[model samples]
Target: MYFTFRQVQYFVLTAELGTISGAATAARISQSAITESIRQLEEQVGSALFSRHARGIALTYEGHRFLRHAKLIISTVKDAEDAFTAKNDNVAGNLRLGVTNLVAGYFLSDILARFRRVFPEVSVEVVEDHRRYIEHLLISGELQLALMVISNIEEQFALSVDPLMRSRFRVWVSPKNDLADKSRVKSSDLRDQKLILLANEDLLESISGWLQGEELIDQVFLRTTSVEAVRSLVGTNTGVAIMPDLAFRPYTLEGDRLEARPVEGLSVTLDVGLVWRQGSPDTDQAEIFKTVARDYHSKR
Candidate 1:
């Protein structure tokens, strides 16, 4: 079965938005266009990708399987384009950047890799620290740019934020846990459950706000600074966790499966992107890096 790149893009978008209309709106095309694209894609694959419902649609088992392949195809195509585009630009210089611990691990690596490929002569120095410290580095002119979670940035008036992506918080559980079967786990559902919290200051503050009340706070089992530790502990059913979907993985390092489900009353999302001093003149290297990072995320 043959399908164009556009078809795969449409399928992935529709799967993510969970509705043809929403995908069409996001893609800036008509709903009929999205429907036809999905219909042709389903014909090509010889299976229904989504199940229609009153509110919207849900991915079928086949759709879930196909979504993974679709995302890989998109990422592969974007990488190729990035590599080709980078070869055309020869701008190079030292770029001093700052990053928080969470953003460094989850988001910065891919952007840095693409940037280096494009500007091989550029020396990239990264300082990893807490979000507040990263912001301080940016403000003090010690860093040219910072990639961090911008949702809780304190000195917003002093910095310019260029947002790349926003990821929602979700409840993560082991497949053996009862919450794994839930379509949406409410905050109240976690009141009595043992909870594993990540030790990032920003995440801790947000979670603390959401999980208010003595009963919920008292349910905290342990707090750690390692993302992998949270994954492993949750995978072994030691405790479930609520974290940003951006850092989520289906399986632990030890090969145990984990599941993420939507939180019913959670409307907060983690915004990650680039931040720079408001009036600082952009150097050639800093400008190029920012462009590359923004383009990379926009494609994704």
Candidate 2:
């Protein structure tokens, strides 16, 4: 009942990393400090949040239930802080934005929601397209700003990019799959496994580049652009998927659980960010949105 935000933050990180040492390393604190925070949080909640094992810890049922509330608490605190500091009550303008399909589904909504809340008077028009077409629109000045996967931008030199977040790729497996119990999965481990690949060109290209020479091409069982389809297939034990953590969900729409495991040899990350034409004059709307996005990602 008296736990601090720091405790909740530590709790969340510990839950995410599944190890006190990993959370400590991420938080730049001592392992004992991370342990204490989790202990205090568990005490405050009056339940055991994690089941400890030789490898690491896993969330107890109570912990999984509490994780949702903990994340909401952090989000609510961030929104409240942003609301208090916002100075754009009188700002009003129309803004044109472009987004890739993957980004539009995962990252755009939260940022757009925050932007709208901060600048309620501003009208926003969003265009969702493939990354190439979005880049064309950005270069043509048809779009003032774009939220996209900036990792493989074809026009990198022609655009100015502000990376918001980097999400590393992980192998998604059904809870019942043999790979789900593994701490880390190697590309070789997936060579014979059925794969459910996302059909987005950018994602496919990135995945292909990393997974090259792994003999996975012939193992790909299905290719679809739908993230949910991939989730469902992976959750139902149809196949495993290697995807960025940004788009990961623990459960499918049908409530089948999925697990994400780090890839041993995969070092690629999906970088999503704001992009604009390099030489174009930054409009007031663009600058304002950038500031909000910067602030939003900074807190995360």
Off by over 4 Å in 2: 1-74
**Runs off by more than 4 Å, candidate 1:** 1-90, 213-215
Worst 10 residues of 1 by lDDT: 82-91
lDDT of 1 by residue, 76-183 (tens): 677677667555466677999998878898888778977776677899999999998899989999999998889899999999999999989998999899898888
Query: What TM value does model 2 have?
Result: 0.79
lDDT of 2 by residue, 91-163 (tens): 7888999998888888877778777866778899999998999999999999999989998999988999999
